[model samples]
Target: MAFVPAPGYQPTYNPTLPYYKPIPGGLRVGMSVYIQGVANEHMKRFFVNFVVGQGPGADVAFHFNPRFDGWDKVVFNSQQDGKWGNEEKKRSMPFRKGAAFELVIMVLPEHYKVVVNGDPFYEFGHRIPVQLVTHLQVDGDLTLQSINFIGGQPAPSPGPMPNPGYPGPGKHNQQPCNLPCMEGAPTFNPPVPYKARLQGGLVARRTIVIKGYVPPSGKSLVINFKVGSSGDVALHINPRLTEGIVVRNSYLNGKWGAEERKSSFNPFAPGQFFDLSIRCGLDRFKVYANGQHLFDFSHRLSNFQGVDTLEIQGDVTLSYVQI
Candidate 1:
């Protein structure tokens, strides 16, 4: 599920350079700070800081500086009592001059997970309690598009399914009250070839969210809603990048079914981040890419409840998954 902004939280759009503002309610676990912008064409360096206060002498809890100078590296550090801490550097750079980018800083219990353009970039351990860092400071060479605070918990461990067999309507387990849509714990930086059980199996209104980066040379990627016991796929969503097509089909009764290859547009691009969502309906499944509706597939199996597992494979690096 796509994360929802907290109540009364408004996103900042086209904020001026060197933007500094107090974080609403301060930083907390399960909250992610998202920034979308483009690096200046002739950029040299840029920095983002989470500090204790807005004053010049404020302590820095997390300092992210991407240097485009001769070093060509990204630096992470902290400062306290006017003294800077040891610098942590990543040699490879993900940001490009004059290119749009999306960045997410997810606050975890132990560390901050930094995702650059939908790829896991780094994990910076906390140098100060997250609650003490109440201000966000962004400056240097970049054009600000928008900044938003998204609310979501970390992904929960998959629990045992109450009923694994095909059951009639309303026979399957129900989603927990606490885990509302867009409130499921997000799994960060999951490995490829990932498979996770659906706590309540397929049901009307259930949605799955997958966010990831496609490698520059990626050929294809596949997402499957499957029946664990019989190895049958209820829905197979495959994006064949090489062919520039998205094939939708099903695998059942030991045979492949007819394919549906039509779509409004192909949203998958090499070296780009994608937000794909699959929402279950009574008769069909709605597929969306980057928040745009792409296509729909009708149910191929009589018992949609039997699709209890989600399997993802191929050339994609997942940054987040909500199932």
Candidate 2:
């Protein structure tokens, strides 16, 4: 399953190329940060920095610099006051100019574990308390796609994500308790529609994240949140390529409900990765694509607690799903 950042901690959208932004709550332990982008065609180097503040020559906690200059090595370092710290370098590069790549930097208690394209690459031990690092800067040669702040514990090992201890859906108002959604990533594959149990069930603060690619000839991509082993669907999201519309609805028994294709924007592209997130609300669900808000679907199954299984079908290759 793909790593899903917690709601409200998403990245800035299309922030001018060489991006520099504040780490909302600073770099807390147990939080994972993801940077997805492509290297420039004539790229020389790119560096990611975590520092004490945005002050001039601030104390740097971690500096990850990947160089494509002849040596082909990744350099890591830290700085205090305005002076430099010992540098750590490794000779391995997985990034290619003009090709898309996803980089994951997870802040752990003692160090930051970095993963590139789903593989463990390196670890940079902490030179300053992670909690004190308050800014993130990305500069140099690259095409930035996204920067997601996934809040939670570190990866169990170097491979698959461990079972998540996602916070529960406490009754926000007078709403009844909900069936807790499963807390781990679910593996999904194919051209056929499939349904899987949401471990405990669906609840607030719980998120459903989908990472997939729409084909060039894609017609539609649909994902539904429905009742347990039943035909009641509370939310149905279908992004139609041919129609250039996103349809939302609910299904009860065998009947299909009204369609919602009001939005005029098209965020889905053929043959590209789209990070989709569905965050539960007290009376509805807020959907997002590539960290941008898409739409919302109000509760229609009488009780939202019945949404215990997620059904996804249509024309797209699913890469990951976090339920």
Candidate 1 per-residue lDDT, tens place, 206-230, comes to 7777777788899999999999999
> Which residue pairs show backbone clashes in model 1?
154-185, 154-186, 155-185, 155-186
Using lDDT as the measure, the top candidate is 1
- lDDT (tens digit, per residue) of candidate 2 on 1-323: 23334543455544566677777545678677777777899889999999787868898899999999898999999999899899999999888887777787988878999888667899999988886776788898998877776554332345532112322112121233343233654453333566678866677757777766677788887888888667688998888888778999988878999988875356776655578878787888877788667887788777787678888888876655666
**Could you list the CA RMSD of all candidates, in the order they appear?**
8.9, 7.4
Q: Candidate 1's error at 182, in angstroms?
A: 6.5
> Candidates' lDDT values, in order?
0.78, 0.72
- The collision pairs in model 2 are 30-152, 180-201, 181-201, 182-198
What does the lDDT come to for candidate 1? 0.78
Clashes of each: 4, 4
